[model samples]
Target: MNSFDSSIETYLSNLHFGHLATRSIASIADLYTFKGLVLIPVLWWMWFQHDERREWRREMVFATLFSGLAALVVGRLLTHWLPFRVRPVYNAELHLQFAGSDLNDALLSNWSSFPSDHAMLWMAVATGIFLVSRRIGVLAILYTALFICLPRAYLGFHYPTDLLVGAAVGIVIAYVMTRDAIRVRYATPALRWIERHPAPSGMLAFVLCLELVTQFDELRTLASSVVRNL
Candidate 1:
């Protein structure tokens, strides 16, 4: 075995072992990942579509989401490149005492363990969305902690500290992108465009398209089907 493998084995061995399962905890985690990460942010923007004070309407919200996505992409890219540590499953020397069911190749990940992409992505989005509303921001942070951070740990993908650092990176990036002047500056052109259009459905459609594209793998799988030939 290579030194890399030896290092990874040692790291995984040091991690505290817990009984891993793919049961109720995983299901609950999935729900939070979807609702908190996906639905809530969209719904929050929709609810305040008519609020003129927010300075975040169609194009602005779209831009902010794009910025959040960019932040997450960068975070994931760095995590993939840097040699941090490895998850137990990938540690060659360690015999895992409690093996959970494989989460299917569809959900399988091979990223180096440290900063979790899930935590970073959702937290970044939460930070961006929260800037428009404090209630939404607090809710976003809480959601990221419970849904993204906790689940990654419970599922054995990351250490609790990994989630913490990921969230911190996400929030810092989001804040840098959404500082007061930046928000106002970016929102101006968006506001002008909205003034010209003044319809919510168009903006909503565009945002939905972005979300769908982000989740294109899932949609593509759904589009294909199992066929039985006689």
Candidate 2:
């Protein structure tokens, strides 16, 4: 597995170019990896536009958001419990392909590189969305693959297997969350509460927006601090 990962990384690193076009692709790729930022607005629009299926849309939005949170939690747990894995660019021996000056070394160095949180979150949300609307779900899947997963791999942020396993975990969790029994037993009640209490829900959304802007680094730091203190 090490050899396979290294060989693929080598191939990709060799393909890196210093062209404006390549940098543009990498920039877009970085932008889309934050699934919450891009998808939340889309989900909001969908929730509002489909008046006929407003109830269903509400459920879908909640499911996707919940599943994404689950993915982040699970991914963080895996990173904590599992052996520390260095990212490709940080591996001193490996020659990683990166757009010069565009790569943020500090950001790349801070996190473990096992199961990709980005892949997991987006895949979970994509699968959850699919449960509600097939057409949009299909589009989400394509976007995840093309714009999200591939770019991460190409940019040496993750090994292909890291993405594969993260995506698989996300899909399974999302599928389970969207099950009829689960939805009836849990989601329905949660949605009812939110509907009854819009103010609190709005406040939560505002907090979430701030967290997204910071890329949840504060939350991660808080979690780490708690673990260390414990």
Clashes of each: 0, 0
Index of the highest-lDDT prediction: 2
Query: What lDDT does model 1 reach?
Result: 0.59
Off by over 4 Å in 1: 1-21, 30-49, 56-63, 92-101, 104-109, 197-230
- Candidate 2 on 1-230: residue-level lDDT in tens? 48888787778777756587677667766653445566556666666675677887777677777777788889989988888788776676674655433565575677788998878878888887777779988988888878878777777778888898999999988888777777667778888888899999779866864564344777777987898899
Q: What TM-scores do the predictions have?
A: 0.66, 0.84
Candidate 2 lands at a TM-score of 0.84
List the lowest-lDDT window of 10 residues for candidate 1. 97-106
For the record, the alpha-carbon RMSD of candidate 2 to the native fold, in angstroms, is 3.0
* lDDT tens readout by residue for model 1, 1-230: 34654454445434543444455556655554453446344644554677564444444455556566666577757876888676645544455421233542333344566776666767777776676667866876787687656655655566556667777887887777766677666656666775677578467646654553353335534644432221
